[model samples]
Target chain A: MSGFIICFLIGLGGSLVYLLRRKKSVKEISLFVTFSLLGFIVWLSIFLGYKVSPDRFFGWIIDSIGL
Target chain B: MENARISGWQFFLLSLNFIVGTAFFVRPGSIIAVSKQDGWIVPLIAGIFAVLIACLWLTLASRNPGLSIVQICTKVAGKYFGGFIALLYIWFFIQLAGWVTRNLGDFMKTILMPRTPISVFHLMFLIVVCYAVIKGVETIARTIEFLAPLVVLIVVVIYLFTLSEWKWERFEPMFQVSTWQLIKDSLPVIGFPYMEAVTLMMLVPYVKSRVKTGLLLGITVATLLISGIVFVTIGVLGVTRTSHFAYPLYIIVQELQIAEFIEHVESTIVIVWLIWIFIKLCISYHCAVTGICQLFRVSDRTWIAIPLVLFISGIAILTHENIVDNIAVDTRYIFQYTSLYGIVLPVLLLFLTWIRRFRKGESGGSA
Candidate 1:
């Protein structure tokens, strides 16, 4: 769980950096950061496996995506 | 303002480092997997592919002596259209930097600090690379030139250390793999590490001399470096036993047991490999940011380095945590564009320039 939290916050921090730093338009930046973060989430979720509660739900979404 | 000279040996050595760093670390054993005893042929074939692309790069450089790739596109394609191509390339270079950056951090996790968060490693790498980029391309090139000789020296030492166990028979039956299988296996070999030399085209305009630079050095130097790399893995582990390890080269170094005391030499290999990977990533990252800044007509690329570094750090984090297939991406997307930019696109531009010149001659003659 701690590993999971750490990965998530690091990821969130990156997206925040993207939002705050780049000069691209908001819509353009939104697409970039969201896709980027979402992809990370998918990889992390699959890596951790379908554990209890919401962890299992995220894992299910990742499995459905089929890499 | 660019008057420094990187020796022929330095260029040769950089080619060696650039080509051998990642693939030789990963691919040699796979070649062994395919050809079994004939894996020796893969580097030769891959070397030829790299040379051909480099020939095109030189041709393009010669056409526009003082112009960078972005400048060439603008001159050849007209303003807006060329800007788009340059933009795509900037994105490509950025993505390439991101990929290699992530891989370097992964290496740290695998070999050194297994428990350290990957994000921190990436952040440090990005920061260091940004400092180099801000210092400018000439500095980076000179630094690489200086580092290149050291890499060659260490590689020589590694080869020497692995000498007691080499097997001559492992490289026989060189064409044993089916042609299709050989070519398919060779894709990652050509495209990933070697093809990235297309990025060097961006540096050519700044070179102090192009007269002595030849395709042989480009082709054969990296050829020897990669062969040294491949053969080191094979010589240390024997070809048959190396296929299963992901970082076979690292494993090969770990096997160096000397006089019962110098048993663990992996640290030496680790340091050398880290410098090699850092230079490779820094080269790609600088090209990407410089390309963007150049396209926007910025007066200096220095100001852009900080945010660009931050962006690449984010990008490294975003790449799939399990990015083992990065080799495949290199085979597919990177190879295609590199071949296009380094070989096909440049050839097309040169041909167009020639044709236009010929037509003008004819018209001028008629008049």
Candidate 2:
């Protein structure tokens, strides 16, 4: 969890630096932050505590599609 | 940008090399595991599906002449939505690069270097791939065009030597599996090696002319080559034995014996396979870096190559517990994930683009 948190913070800071450096729009910054958080949360869920079984996730999709 | 443009043959070779990448060595075991003796049929069916998907992708790509898929997404959808989609593709490309890196590392550790850790191999591969990415796509394309023929020649020689051992009787009771089973198993083949040409969407803009025709031909040639490989594997090893081995093609090459001498040519085959894998890694890494540059409005992407290589190599090393887990994850879940991005996303994008264009045409006609 600590590792993920640090990685997320680093990414967030990097995004800000990029936005400033490129002179991008506020909307772009917001989009970046939103997507970064979204990705980080999912990644955290996968890597943080109990590992999510990729098989189960995929099996559910296969069953949902009736395949 | 003008200097970056590649000739049509270079474009064709790039696509061909990308399509017949690491998957050639890694896929046969899984395909045979599913389709049994009829595993060769999987590539045939997947080839047709790939051609159709390629045609649709080409149409969408040609509609926006100079833009890669990332730019096309931004144009078709508004900025935020397109940015989100483009990011997904960038992640996908980077992840694929990592996966291929890990695969090569695993193969080397298993077969050649038992004592060396896999990360060492990954780092070495990533360094070369980073160098290629920095050299730009034109260099990468020309590199593949110049070397692909020699690689093909080596593969042909390997095939000829192995032909003496092929048992036609081994293919007995073909298509024993039910139609549903065949189709279900074929999905992985389609989603993986075939639809993976979708990555070419990011490279199509670099081609000088007849972009659609170039893509179709490249894909066709790749599909044919893949089909030939699967067929040879099944014929030489038989379906059961082929599926039983971890690396069927590698094992088959190891088993090759010509007349009396000229045996144990597996090392030569490995060299050719490594070259193919290297080209594959470069294209994936290039696409990821280029996509990120376009996404972030970065004028020069080469400066970020080392950082990206570190991130990718770290992920590749840390992703799965081991090679067994890696293969399991790939065979079980990859098709589902790939379907979403490779098939569903492109189909939806094409449909939306068509509708938008039709409405504009209607409005103009009314005016």
Q: Candidate 1 recovers what fraction of true contacts?
A: 0.00
Candidate 2: Cα lDDT at B166: 86
lDDT of 2 by residue, B119-209 (tens): 7898788988889898899889888988888899988998888898888888888769887777777777777777767788888778788
Off by over 4 Å in 1: A1-67, B1-13, B169-175, B178-181, B211-216, B328-334, B355-367
Model 1 over residues B82-111: C-alpha lDDT tens digits?
A: 787777667667767876777788888877
For candidate 1, the per-residue lDDT at A50 reads: 29
**lDDT value, residue B186 of candidate 2:** 77
- Cα lDDT for residue B263, model 1? 83
Docking class of 2: incorrect
TM-score for predicted model 1 compared with the true structure: 0.78
Best by DockQ: 2
Show the lowest summed lDDT stretch of 10 residues, model 1 chain B.
Answer: B1-10
